[model samples]
Target chain A: MVSLILSTAVRYIFPLQLLFSIFLLLRGHNEPGGGFVGGLVVAAAFSLVALANNVWTAQRTMGVNPRVLIGVGLLAAAVSGLQALIAGQPFMTAAWIARDIPVLGKVGTPLLFDFGVYLVVIGVTLTIIFTLMEE
Target chain B: MMQVNTVMNIWIVLPILIPLLTAVGAVLAWNWRRVQRVLSVIGSAALLGAGLKLLLTVWTDGILALQIGSWPAPFGITLAADLFSAIMVVLAGLLAVTVTLYSLASMDMERESFGYYPILHILLMGVCGAFLSGDIFNLYVWFEVLLIASFVLLTLGGERAQLEGAIKYVTLNLMASALFLAGVGVLYGIAGTLNMADLAVQLAKMEHPEIVTAVSMLFLIAFGIKAAVFPLFFWLPASYHTPPVAVSAIFSGLLTKVGVYALFRVFTLLFVHNIRYTHTMILIIAGFTMVTGVLGAVAQTEFRRLLSFHIVSQIGYLLMGLGLYHPAAMAAAVFFMVHVVLAKSTLFLVSGVVHWLQGTYDLKKLGGLYASAPGLALLFLIPALSLAGIPPLPGFFAKLALVGAGLQLGQYVISAVALAVSILTLFSMIKIWNEAFWKPQPLAATCASAQPVLLIIPIVLLALVILGIGFFAGPLFTLAARAAEQLSDPAGYIQAVLGGA
Candidate 1:
């Protein structure tokens, strides 16, 4: 099922798609782009690689296990919510920083939450894809 | 107010967090069998502890509501616990602890190591979330969470029968979910908010009741299927008996009960404008559900399959209590929920232990438990008798209260039907006793060598709880009556959530 041309094209295309996904995530604070959309884009990037080459190659390229990503992502999202307990807000209250960081812009727990959503989406999407493809 | 709520609300949140964190721990330690197993016990116990505390807090402190992210009512995702929700949380936690312990002996290592424990805990998280959530949309999310987890548990072993059952289970449930989402959308369109409290307030002042009535039907059918009542229960008898007994035990305990919980919650709180039309319809359905369910059980030859039919039958009684709408009846209904959850799950766990020993769930091929294993016979008899509504057991008291309430109102037909169904329930339970335990030992039966004490422990623990409920029926009924009173009037619940609106 592999095509040399598809594989060659995906090598360059995948990184760009990932960068775009991160961009979507960053712009999510006050814009249409957010965790869900950004996560879909990243999943699409990896899926493209899987389509061009194969699942094992894509797995190696991704570096971390999809399930581990889910675990870490959930932990991050939960932590982002619970961090509010320290600030004396209710659980999941969006605590924010008054200053901006480079590339990420003004930081907050919501952004961390978004990032967590991003990773979970990628993990879940790929796991489903990989399982179906293998079957 | 926010400061006070922040401290008070952790009880609401901890039930959910404990499971989520434990599932995370299991996933992170994916290959570490010992850690995952240990986490399962400790996590489930923590949930139980948290639920008990939450129950006490709600009992003494009155109903508690928390607006997540500090958003005001009608806007934020709210978590609230009246007595009803608290009771459900405690039941779920208890089921979790028992089922998790049972899985340690009954479930195979392959299934356990293949992410079973983690998914099971996630299922618990979803159940707790569903119980505590105070918004319609959030309830849907929790429903999906539990749905997804149950789907995995249903198909965990990937057997042919499991896949077949999973298809029916998932397809019907997904269809029901679609209807539920559509109902939520239409409801939000009409009421302009997703919070249940706000909807209640807005809906009470609604001018045209037809649209609301129509929306109410959509919810009724949606939850009806989940509750597996009357004609909507084709999926229950098909899929429930196919899962590993441990999965069946938890699903039997918590899943349908959640559906029943939602039905009563909405009927009491959200859709009280037209009781004559809605409650009467519910009553009719409840009667049919009872008759059809017991009749189905009488025809089943398999142990778990037979019990599965009884699940449908028992659900009819809960709906009957709801339909009656008497305070005493509703209190009896709550007590019935507590009894059934403990008793039914224990029944499934016993079935698992039987299969572990006899190597089959087919009632035809099994016999002689009475002579061979008196302890197991006693364990099975406790729940089976309670389920049949025998005296001195919780089931008997539940039936007496419900029938008493119906007869008091001169609803003679349903009352007669209720008494008749109790007789049939006893008939089938005795049928099982005669066939599987009381009769002579079959020629081909070879009892397994190792009767894992692990399998017996949960059954024994739950059996004691059943007896305890029976012995303490007076206080339990008093508490249930108090809960029923609170449910009958939603004003206090609304006040607790929305503040001095």
Candidate 2:
């Protein structure tokens, strides 16, 4: 019942949006576009896909349960803080190991925590949206 | 014997962390329901251990203060645990474990699958965070976390009755949150600091005392609503009886107490400069809250609803200690809080079991619990009697301490009301006993025979704690006294958190 052109456009747009989200997430620590924003962006893209196609197709694209995504996201964030506990520092005291990745600059616990935040925002948003859409 | 170091700070943070991790873990393994259940219990146990360590560490090392991200005070968020905060955190941990244990048996599988464990742990994380936070803004953040979780838990079943209750609960609490935030914003604007200890020092030096008093009134209304004091308490009984009993038990145990704790903390630490005015208002509110709440309870015929009303009434006693504003009174408040948290939750948990077995919370329909489940009937008596301020019970000591403080302070009218409220409280509790246990069943319907081990364990454990507190009141009173001394002296708190003394 839907137009082929719109679906085709969404297919291309989804991957591009996802890539942009990753860029925003990686750039977050030093820039304005952080995990929360990036995650929201990705969730918005997925929502568009679901709207264009169907929720089932969107779920297939996600491949993992959104609830599990939330759990993993929380773990990642907690681990970033736990690293400080392990190193005999105060809890959540950011400690970094400089490993230069090509475009992302130095990767560190703060970035890791931001990544976790990104996933959590994505998971929570998609979970709520998907449930409401199904209803 | 206590080493004050960065590593020690981890102990201060673990009660919050452990619950967060557990909630995450439970959610991640949602597909495996058994795994989720096991993980939640283990997580709660770990929190209890963490709480014990934190309490012991604070008891030995003085106030244990730590800055998250190693940022110094006035700039970074500090999680500081003095004797009072430590006591609260430990009590939270204890409540968490017992409540979770009760939920394991009493809660339905459908509810558990609806992310119940994750939400419960998050609620505890909020509570521990609220207790440990040294910044007013951080406290607000924690309050939001707990509030959100509570909203989910309260409305999880999607019953028409629950939905109605949830609406009232959420609306009033949201109003409270808004008021609290407004007060925090004004306080921050005036003092230019969010750290509670720092705010205390700055507030003392501020030239505009009138604005400070206005801000204090804002806080009083906000906390008064949350604490369900007097005219502000209509929402509590309206909503609390609607939740699943485990949910009710925790809410009954910790939620309002958190509000009372905030009132005590802010008034004693930051708003002390205007005590004659602010505390006298608190004293007047406390007196009315007691009379109205007990009278409401006397009029209730339902089980959980009666307990809900009692929670409001007991808040009056807790606030009375704060209103008195002396070390003995404050210590009594702390002791009474601990007693209420344990005893009240036990009553709710018992109500859960009765509901489970008898299939109703209405006292009119229920009868002969003593004949049907003698063990549960017995378990109920301990907390019930203890609640009524029977001698040699923890509640007796708790009430005695508060009344003594009131009498000592020569607040005779309030003291008389406190004594009178205890008698009325006993009368209502006896009403429950006579209707639910002593009276013959109106219908000879068969009650369930088997007692779930998971359910009984928490009930028994809580009862034992109430009894323990009653018999061995020495150590607890001393600890509470130390906490009271710290609360009485805000300079000591400020120096410990800000100066690392």
Candidate 3:
């Protein structure tokens, strides 16, 4: 019963951490934190959830397997790189936008690449932890 | 400036994206083996198609660049494909298809239940991303992606050897990563921009000889560790042999080449002005790498271990070409990279078949497989000979190109060492043939069902590719030459990246 209450509180914290990770990634371009660190933060959150719940249960709740997360992350990152090609620039040349929107107006591929970073960290960390847990 | 946009731009991204999406689908379908198989096959096929299409596009266009979010050069992340990157993508795609097919046939269904295809796809994505990325820092990110996937795959089975190997692999690679970051940091501090083309322009303007040497050395060490160059390669043979054949095949084919690609990129573009210092170091390293690597191979008793050692030795040949810094030498490196990928992967696949039949990779315990699996033996023989640089095989032409270039550059010692290494390579192949195929079947040899046709198909296909490159050397050599020329002349590459004519 106590475990159930703790699990509920942990679940509430998870989304908050994920949001913070995204914030870190977005603000990383000129700041100390970036996609790689932000991704690790997200992975750490998922890892905590896995530790609290069973690996299988946490995996199910993830809605996608860790490996797939890695794949998607890689895809997202590659697509971010491709954005340069589409604009007739060289490979991995960074592109951006600085528009005035109410909320997140100045979003760009760097942030997209950061999202990819988040996915990879989560996928890789979970894969290592879960695979070890199985052993 | 005139702009030309084509569907080929989409093709450039698909090789990386398809596997990534399929990996996700595989995980979601983890409970359903049939769905996983279908998704992997479809994804791999799509990647294959994309790779071929991109190759054709690059052949015609000279180089293709894609700007993310419609951002212009020097400011945006780009995925650019020159002839070299395009060919690497095609090679990787083909290898992925074959390895996936082999995995489908070879992997135990029960053990593979936990999203194996997903991991495979992600690994392929990392490789494809590394190949297509145009920025130095972006390349580092992709390297991490590839390394992490490979780490998972290495430890997938959770065996003691796998765990041990994974630890070493991860530890060594992590060190490489740290070094890579340090190198990037130094380069960034020196040049201001992390994009390869932009760095090239900035580096061209810097006239400080000491700073240039220091930065190049840093890059050399970082890429050297990844490429498994001499003194940094002890971890490779130990770890590579622990994985399943499909995993080993892909790792052997794609992983080290990423390092080679980085070396080729940096040396030809950013550090071209200081060829005397950098190229001379490359020459010495290449010589030691060749001598020690082949010597390590000669000492190995296990098939996979021996092959892993050869991987190091072969890297020497690639670096040798880079050391020469001649157009012909660079062409030779390109040709050799393709040849090594095909030959090494084929050899690993054949070893897989042998292990499947005999349940051992030890030379002493194996014999007489030729009678039971003549087809498998023949499949192994072609790539073995190709790797040994036998005449009429692509490996021979690759070696010939390097040697010819070395001779022209008057690096007689390097040319001579190249020939000596070829002889040693042949000796190593003979050792395998003698122990695994030509020797009498041990009385303890256990028989298994006729070799799985799926596994053999990919091995045979790769062997045929080796032969095809050998037969059609003229056009491919010309292509490689063009790539070398383009890489050597960084003006176009820089212009494309910096949005300047």
Structural similarity to truth (TM-score) of each candidate: 0.98, 0.98, 0.87
Q: Which candidate is the best by TM-score?
A: 1
lDDT of 3 by residue, B1-501 (tens): 424553557767777777777887787677889898989988998898899899998888667776655566677677788888889999988998999999999987655885578888888989999988888889999999888889889998889999998888899899989998998998999888888888888888897967977988888988999999988888899899998899999999999989989898889888877789899999989998998999999998899999999999999999999999988999999999999999999999999999988889999888888877888888888899988899899999999989999999899998999899989999999999999888886767666757778988898888888889989999999989998888878877776556554
Native contact fraction (fnat) of model 2: 0.93
Chain A only: list TM-scores of all candidates. Answer: 0.95, 0.94, 0.82
lDDT order of candidates, top first: 1, 2, 3
lDDT tens digits, residue span B320-391, model 2: 999999999999989998999999999999998998888888999899988888999989999988888998
- Give the Cα error of residue B258 in candidate 2, in Å: 1.0
TM-score of 3: 0.87
DockQ, structure candidate 1: 0.78
Candidate no. 1 TM-score: 0.98
Once fitted onto the true fold, the runs of candidate 1 whose alpha carbons sit more than 4 angstroms away are none
- Alpha-carbon shift of residue A57 in model 1 (angstroms): 0.6
Model 1 chain A: lowest-lDDT 10 consecutive positions: A81-90
Task: Rate residue B483 of model 1 by lDDT.
Answer: 88
